[model samples]
Target: MTRYRPPQPQSSPYISKPGYKALNEELKGLWKTRREVTAALSAAAAEGDRSENAEYIYRKKQLREIDRRIRYLQKRLDVLIIVDKPPTNQQQVFFGAWVELEDEEGNSVAYRIVGPDEFNVEKNWISMDSPVARALMKKSLDDEVSVQRPAGPIHYIITGIHYTED
Candidate 1:
């Protein structure tokens, strides 16, 4: 059987070059998370001896996790390439392009295609590797496309597309 270890948190990215600067910014934010966790740990430790201090142990665990993430981000930031602009062509879908879709039922949904690192489903963002994105790639506005999902093949029409920094 596979071990119970959880998957490491994914890096946030939107381009192939890798976003070093953004990763640095993310590491900086994580440092703040570490600092807050450390303070909590100290406060917990100061309450009493170590044996029965659940708060101390809990906070220490939290701090350790935070530090692990911080260290990874620090190392990862060194390898990413920052992408600050879009491609010259705007007529076709490309990475970072916001695509609005409508199903045959006429329900509309919009999503921004980003690198594997920056997929936020709730915000209507998808990884460029996603099937829908794959099917939509190189398709012009108003093009019709279909994706074969587990639920069955779903068809959509590209209603609109735009490239804007939101």
Candidate 2:
């Protein structure tokens, strides 16, 4: 049998205050759900045959999902470096800053640069390692930036940048 070892955590580049709080809350919620599911699974098993028990199967699935999330949160928490304060200069882009971009078509998009663990496009959050964030970093408003994407290069003009606790 091969012996398995958990990998050492790597240093996290950055994380926003709100994102960190969310992760912490999520971990707590997962643990609570884990306990609830385990109890429910035991109850389902006591009811009778395990093979045909729907409650048992459902609880088992829920437990697996909770365990997966718990493991992820544990690993991520170890690596993350939280940054509560934004950069002093407001004119340039920096971690945890909300940035506005204008594409060639003149359409504008706003995104907030955040840690990888907090990256959510639908929520307007982006990772620091992302191509768009990479291009925007250290750039001031009105600066033209080009990023290399899998499809090709994409260009953007920085329209605005802001940082706030909320």
Candidate 3:
């Protein structure tokens, strides 16, 4: 099978105020953890031969992961534009809007439109660049949106829209 893959498109550079704060906090915490890991790695290296040292190998892997995430967050935070206030027109769906949708089966689902870097499935926060969010953008109450999925197209009606910190 062919394993070639194309580069993905760049995500939107807009983030909510809370999302920005969270990213900044994470970057700071990662730096602290990296320092601790460096110390542990050095200690492990000093113990003896490095080839058989499990602690040293594990610490090295941990440090690499930390450094990767740190670099990503640093670059992302530099370009992110924080959207702290609600739009002048709150009737439509926009970035950081809490949206409620009713599906064909009459089941209701709630989601928040957020930046790609801060999307949390557990909290139903979707990335603004996601298919559903793109369909919902600029849509008003009672507006219908259809998102194309791998299986088929799913339709939804905009039941509610709100702008809240949560």
Candidate 4:
């Protein structure tokens, strides 16, 4: 049997100013970490019997992971378009907007629309390419949004929209 996987969708090239800075910092740190790991790997290799050397194996794996992230960051950084300015029309929902939504149950939720690279669930930051964000885009306060989720169509009403981090 063949294991066939569909091609993944492309991530949006937009990134917030802070997200770009964070990626740059991470890339720099990874380079420094790679140097230290390389030194450790060399030290472990010098101890002889690489097949039995746990430290050498561990360092090699660590270095590989670090390199993989560094490469991804480098490429992604090169193509990312930093979105630092707020939209001219602040009344409407757009990128980098902190949107407050209300459900039919009177439950309120706040979500910040952010770039795919910077979206964090803990921070309530949703990727702009996400279904919820896409549905919310260009919507004004009191606008109703219906997102088609796997379970069902989830509904939300835009209660507030702000451009700032708060």
Candidate 5:
């Protein structure tokens, strides 16, 4: 028997316009790949015994994974709200805003608050549900915010907030 586990909290149903388009393209690509895999499986099945055909087994597994991802993307895309425009109140931090923060030690860092689907650490894009993003939400320039992290509490001052790319 499998161990019992609680259901996870639902992620925010928000995505950037580019993210939405990328997901749609991925779904389409997966469909094409699935068709190719199905054809390969058929060819492999005709060549040997069902139980001993490694090529058939691999193709079947690949097709199953592709189908699973296609299902997930279809469901996720249906509910995502694309945020293509900046919020009316640009003075405060909001979704898709690029925020610059300064720590007590005078170090500075910047991050863009984006949907969970598009958060990329390499680009300094943070998910809206993250602790830092949550603390900065609705905060204005010069405002001090504290975030409770696993390492402990950290304070930051909002140095800049911009809705457009810089």
Candidate 6:
């Protein structure tokens, strides 16, 4: 029997213009790849015994993964709100704001506050729902913010906030 799992809370639906475009392109690419996978699956099925065919089994699994991603992307794209312009009040940190912060040790780091779907850690983009971003929201430059971490509370001073024209 399968375990019962509750549905997750809805994530923020906001996405940057470029992020939205990238998702749309990914959906389009998925469709094309799905078609190719289906064709390969059919070809493998034709050459094999249903019970013992590795090629057929592999192709079927590949197709299932592709279809799952396509379904998710289609649903996600329908609800995303694209934020193409910077907020009117640029001084305060908000979604899409590139914020620079200095830690207690005077080490500086920059991060862009973005929606969950668009957050990229490697690029230093943090989800708005994250503890650090939540504490930073609506906070202006020179403000001190504290975030709760597993290790303990960490403090930062907001040194700058910038918004880009997307």
Q: How does each model score on lDDT?
A: 0.80, 0.87, 0.97, 0.95, 0.93, 0.92
lDDT-better candidate, 3 vs 5: 3
Clashing residue pairs, backbone N/CA/C < 3 A, model 5? none
- lDDT tens per residue, model 5, 1-166: 8899999889888888998998999999999999999999999999979798999999999999999999999999999999999999999999999999999999999999999988999999999989899999999999999999889999999999998744
Q: Give the TM-score of each candidate.
A: 0.76, 0.83, 0.94, 0.95, 0.92, 0.95
Candidate 3 weakest ten by summed lDDT: 1-10
N/CA/C clash count, model 1: 3
Best model per lDDT: 3
Stretches of candidate 5 exceeding 4 Å from the true structure: none
lDDT of 3 by residue, 1-166 (tens): 8999998889999998888999999999999999999999999999999999999999999999999999999999999999999999999999999999999999999999999989999999999999999999999999999999999999999999999977
- lDDT value for model 5: 0.93
Across residues 16-104, which tens digit of lDDT does each residue of candidate 1 receive?
44344466677888888888888888888889897799999888888888888887766665554556678788889988889999999
Each model's total of backbone clashes: 3, 0, 0, 0, 0, 0
lDDT, model 6, position 82? 92
Error of 1 at 15 (Å): 4.4
Expressed as tens digits, the lDDT of each residue in 98-158 for candidate 6 is 9999999999999999989888989999999888999999999999999999999999999
The C-alpha stretches of model 3 lying farther than 4 A from their native spots are: 1-5
C-alpha-based local distance difference test score of model 3: 0.97
Candidate 6: minimum summed lDDT over ten consecutive residues — where? 157-166
